[model samples]
Target chain A: MNLKRTTLIPLDDDSLAESIFKSFIEKEMMLLMVIIGDTDTIREAIPKADNLAQLSYFKMERWVLWVRNYEILSETLKKHLKASDADKSKEDYNNIKCLCFSPILDKVDGIILKNAELSYASLQQSFFKAQAHDALAVNI
Target chain B: MYYLKRISTLVLVCFTIGIQAQIISVIENDKDQKRTISLTDKQIVDINSSLEIQLSKLQLLDAIQQQFPQLKQHLELESKLIKLQQALRNQSAVISILEKQLATASEQATFFEIMNGFLTDIQNDPLLNERYNDLMAKFFSTDTFAPGTVPEPYIFSNLNNDMLQIEQELASLEADIYAVSVLAFKKDSSGGDRVHIQNYDTYTNRDYVTIKRWVTSLSTEQKQQLEALNDIAKQNNLKKTNVFNELKIKLLEEFKSITCIKDFKNNSIEFINNIQLNDVVPTEVKNKIEQLNLLITRFETLFLLLKTDMDQWQITLLLDIKSEVETIVTLLKTIDTNFSDVTTLINQTRVKTKFMPLVSEFNTCYATINKDFETLKQGAALLFNLQNNYIANKAIGTEVLAFTLDNLPDKGYINLKGTGQRKNGDELLIELVLRLPSAVENAPEQVVTIEQREFIMQLTGPRSEVAIGLIFANPINKEDLNLQNDRNFFYTPSAALLLKFGSNKSHFYNDFLDFGIGLNFATPDFNTDGTPEFGTGIITTAFKNIISAGVNYNLTLDSFYWFFGVNLPFNLPGIPINNIKN
Candidate 1:
């Protein structure tokens, strides 16, 4: 066996950054990225994703995501600042793409996801429907 | 005085002899003389005293001659010995003069060593002329230490602020790169090796741990430099901060690879190219060069001093200088570490005890650098040696064949007969591969076969050459029936040597197969209990996958081969459980 040749591929800045993120995630399993951008843009219509269900609720071992633009809240900084560069000011306008979002509470058992999202009237009706169906299913 | 003593002893001896012989002689000379009987007190006392004194003088002379035979060459040794003793009391002044001369010589040698070290330091430093002047001024001045003057605090504070600014700039740059997901940076103005640290996204393409390590090293260096300045400030009694000390200790614990070779005209042609000043060099590089110079001088001095210690070989001095060089190399590394907790912990102990941690860290970081330097050094020496012993181009063209054949004849030879050739006064490599098969009863229908792959490279020089070969075989064959008489092919090559043990190639092949003999000292392939009972030649059906039915001499044996090599491959013929519907 012999080494025939070796080639190094050139990558654009954004792609290179994504590749670096992927590599880190592969090595470390789960990592956090704090992204900063315009607040309204992030809050508008939900972001398009290839694997939404897998990402929407991270139940598996490893997951990754990009925050649209949640500007940094440091009082001294004027514009949105990347979390990694939070130590420095954002006058240079370095955007942080991914900010870590981990939920501390899991209230799914007490209040189901659908019930949690429903209004008071819809929640009451849904609760009744759940109880009735559950009782019927148990009886049968 | 000597004659008087000798005369008295002679008179006593004569008296004693006369007494013993008196009666006999008296009879013979009775009429000639009458014997005197009367004696006086003064005469007796004088005779006794003379006898005692004569005996004592004789004893003294004998003792003097025994101890100082050289002293008797010109004068009576006894008198000369007494005079010599008296002279010792008066020679204290001369002894002192000799001791003073010895001390002066020693001091002069030390001064030479120190001067050589200083010269080397100046040679290595970038600001060579300025450093030379400063060193000269410092050396010439009487006060080595300016006792009470502290360096200004504001200078260090400014340095700290500048470092902070650099850190801030780096942090900002990092954030921008992360946002953009930029993983790598193209080689810019400085060099191809440089990587922009701020962009975490681009860093994903590289080993994060390794990258983190490099950045940590640079960060630590910058921190330590600031700390050193701060230390200078503190020593001068300037106001000090706790962070500088912390930084120092951290830096001390870290080991950074040295860049001592400077630069190449290109990476390949360093021999013809001169070292450029801009290349990254090791820390304390100047001091190290000076230390090396001192060692060389010390070696030279001791070599010169061999004449003085001719009775004993001068190797003692040479050994001392070599040991000193090794110690200095270690010392330079130890001194390079920062003044952090690690440094403090190490420094708290004696120098002997403190060196352990410092050396371990330096070794860990400098491992790659040291390996590279050693390779370059060896390569340069070898190339020089080769150049000096130039070989003719015509001699290199003569090809030498190196092939290993199995004990079985025609079916087992991988050499493309005599096609090998040398090029440009260098050797070309040729490898031999062969397979042999043998059969047995009470087993699978196909006979078991052994596959041998022999790797050999023949260095055919002018008229003569050397060949080094290794053979690795799989599924080795053996003959059995009698425990002691069983013969088997070796599973691996047994020998490696640099010798010119020659034999005819044809005879080697004939004896190897016909007589069932192999290379001398070749390790046996199988033990008595495991030797296979085989007959016909075994052949492999397909490469790595299908094995020709092997005759199993013993059905109890789990694996067919008696022993296995380190590179023994384990694979079962295809029995796939899963298949795709195409």
Candidate 2:
């Protein structure tokens, strides 16, 4: 089956990301995500963002973090793979990777994650891609 | 004024004519005993019932007369009792007055005779014997009887035969003392002991027993005095007896006079009530009488007509008058054997030649009186029937007849019931019922094999609707064993018009119509293998098809809370539901 992703805008003073996550839970889907620290917040110098609580089925520690600039995307990926021990020489790394990130449109991006699995490198890469798309759309 | 006077004269003439027309001859023999012959059904019924009632009354009277002498005597005494009572009163007064006088005079005479005897005794013995001398001395000394003195105020004292004899006591004294003295004492004293020497003892001892032993001689004057007093008393009693006899005779004569007049009046009323005097006779008889009377005034004309006519019709018309008079006389004789009909025959003889005038006179005599008699008879019959014979108000007479149809089995029975009369009307009902075990539920429709279905049918015909109504009264006591049975009832019920048909026994069934509904239940019978072939449940469906809209009920007796109404079925067959569980 072909996979597709849909984004929801944050409501005024409301957790639009959490609402989307809850819709996934009602459909009994396996994975959910929320993007934080995007270009809109960096350019405006805003800090102290709220985080959604992780349910028992999904842990907050598995969430991906990303920087905003496209130039840092390669650098962010290189550090993430090292910290995740992707260079452990001959070990199989495909199943160990729990997530991946892809930029499809200016403020839109894709985050792929394995159901009920986690990895350090996949989280860092997905985070950096999400931030780049947010910065690119904010700059325009 | 002239017209008014003329009118008055005319009125006076008319008033005289009216009086002349109403001049009813007080014929002693006339009586009306006419019977009404009615052709109407209602009148026929009334007359029949009236005849029955009168016959019963006559029977009662006859029975009383036969068995009770008091009743016969009462009838005989009833006529003369008033006069007899008056006579009895008069006679009783005379007898009582005469008796009072007789009683008083006789008592007086007795006292006088007694006084006379006493006076005689005094005169006969001037010197007096010892006893007489003692008594006379005592009598003269006592204040009550002293000589030449008034005796006891009410006491009688008389002098007799020129002797100063007290008539009242002198006779008694002589008889009492002298008889005893002579019997007891001899002429010479023979006894050795002298029992009495004092005059007082001789005078005081006057009793027969005492004197017989104490005295020896008696005086003849005393005996004569006693005899005369007894004769005087007897003569007084004889006179009183004559007076009583005379009073009794006088009373009887007076009673006879009043009773004769009363009897004449009663007999006169009874006679007038019996004969239909003014009743209209046949026109033919009237014409004949008229012709006979006319013949005398028209003798010359009749003689001229005699040459012209020798007609049998005219001769027969004249003969019919004689026959009609004979018939009337015969009828009168049949009613009262003692009636001579002499006045009728004499009147007919005087008018024998004046036929037309006699017919008019006789018709005039009987017609109005006949009308009056008819009115009285009708009124009396109505009054008596309504007053005494109208017993249907509260009196209920019931008669029940039960008959079983022979065509059915022994278990099957039919009863024909009839009630005598209740209140005022008659009611009739009939019921046909069939009771079978619940096993019949599984049986085929044609499985009515037992002879006549062993059913029981009942019919009740009563005289009134207020009486017991048509009802299916269940008598079964077992709750588990439901004994509801199939019932088919039909008969004409009580109603004004229907009750008339009930009186005619043959037409009773023809006029009556009825319909009924019921339920049936029972224990299911077992098959050969002990399996119950029939199942039980409510069997409420019912349908009745009659000429009218008969009724259908689920549970007719259950307060009619749930029922099925059958409305106007036209020639429909019985609708049965065997499988209630279905």
Candidate 3:
């Protein structure tokens, strides 16, 4: 699959990334959005971005992470997973919450998103490159 | 409104009244002796009930006459009932005519047999038989049809026509009022208003698909067990279809095996919720399903909180889930899976959502309708009970069927006309019949009945009487001796007012040997020239007041005198014997 990257400016605020989400649909792509950042600004923007995302099997898929403290968030999530798995009533096996952040987005702050150059002539930055690669993998 | 009630008792009391231990006073004709009647308990009950029924009819009629004067409107209402009956009768008559015609047409359906009879006669004659055989040989052929397989349902041969033509037309018709006139109680009518049942949108007819969520996680111990389980699975040639359950069972053998949280997986939550629980879905039910699905999703996260020992929100969510599930379960259970109509669906939809209130509503509707129906039923019962008679509100007459008598006391002359019958030469039965006008239920009542009283009676006879008289004094008085011999005695008026007793049956004081004392007014014969002055005196009565000889002394006259007379209202002298014969 050929990979392409898309960059979103004005990301350092508690505002919905409507333009980016709309762009994915305009570019004739599956409606998938994965927001990744480790900042207070990113944490506050989760609900703001969530308002724009239609959460339904027939609608769109959303994977968001507003990592305040990476260790605390990861441990908290792991603890939940461990405890929930122990609970038979939860039946969490089918409700597999995908923690997909391996070869795609990294623990970059909102400043990186704001500082990333709009490479109109070139392909994209590495972070954008990784997002495009993730998007392409989803398309395949 | 209750004018007709208990008219039976009124009729009974009018004639034979039982005073002592079921003994009835029945006056019968000596020769005819209509019926030797004894009032048995059952017979009394029957008579009372029948009389009550009869009298209720009469009373209703009278009440309808007096209270409801809308006779013309009532007759108009009756016209509807008459029309209904007429229509039924007319329909029956038409059906009868149709049946007769149908029977006639049935007999005419043997035309083929009639033709065969002629053909048989021809064949019986020898000369014709030869021609008939020749013709049969020429015309008659094999009884086989064209060779083709019969259709699965070859019904053409079974469609035998009756060939009886029946034509019907309306010769005469009456379509005005008689065609239809019906009366029935309806809501929001002239008398009072009634409400219509409401239609709720959530009364679903479709069965909702259940949404289930599954949890999957693994611990280090379960992961270690998975290798052996996988080996076992490979030995059994097991796959996802069969081995998952075994794997799950194996995983659960150890505690804290977060490896496999469940043995089953159903990822149809999003499928059903998106496709089915949509726009056309029953809104309230849809909302509940959506809310429940939301809670199940929330429980997944809440489970995390519960395990993490964040107690507050988890407990609330669990309680909410339990309550909401109970509500939905009860509601769904009440739904009839096979309801034939919308009414049943709505009724079922209004399940025990709020257990107390909903059940109370059902009971309320039932009780209200029941009470109203009972009222209407009582009214209809009353109307039907009024079969053929009208009881009277007021009854007045001079005489009735019978009279009873009591034995008189022996004190003095009672100044009454009494007839007594001595039974077995021991007990006396006095027939106290009077030819005076009588009344019942307050209509100027008068019963001139004199109980067999003693010889002596109170002067007022249980009712007050003021007596007045014209009197003449004798000349033996010292004051009157000074007057001329011709004017020695003077004409004067006398009067008395007496307080009476024994008037009511309850008062037995002076009941038999009756006596009365009262003050009187008379003349003071002081002037010797035949003029007298009037003054007061004291008076008394005796001998049942039968011989009321007026020999009273005058308190005003201050003299002793002799006189014979009567009267408070009118004065008459010299006519003795206290006569009240009128």
DockQ of each: 0.00, 0.00, 0.00
Candidate 2 chain A, poorest ten consecutive residues by summed lDDT: A48-57
| Decoy 2 TM-score against native | 0.11
Give fnat for candidates 1, 2 and onward, in order: 0.00, 0.00, 0.00
Candidate 3, B89-139: lDDT as tens digits: 233332333234232322222221222233333333343334333333222
- By summed lDDT, which 10 consecutive residues of candidate 1 chain B come out lowest? B45-54
Between candidates 1 and 2, the TM-score winner: 1
- What's the TM-score of chain A alone for every prediction? 0.21, 0.25, 0.26
Q: Candidate 3: which docking quality band?
A: incorrect
Model 3 C-alpha RMSD to native = 53.9
Report the TM-score measured on chain A for model 2.
0.25
lDDT of 1 by residue, B1-582 (tens): 999999999999988744432210100111233222111111111000000100112223333345436424322422322222222222333233323423343332332233233333333333432433344334323464242221112222332454455445444442211000111112223222212222111111221211010111235775796588668746643222233333323422331233321121122122112112313323243234334334434433442343233223122123332343344344434433421323344344333252454345444544544553344334334432332222211111111111111001111111111222111112111111111111353221221111111111211111121111222222333333233533453333222111121111222322222111111112223343454323222212111111122222223222243322221133335522121110
Error of 2 at B263 (Å): 55
DockQ of 2: 0.00
Task: Please write out the lDDT profile of model 2 over residues A37-135, one tens digit for every residue.
Answer: 234432221111111101111111212222332232323233433443222312222212222222222122223322311221122233333333222
Q: Candidate 3: list runs displaced more than 4 Å.
A: A1-140, B1-464, B475-480, B486-490, B503-514, B524-531, B542-558, B562-582
CA lDDT of each candidate? 0.27, 0.26, 0.30
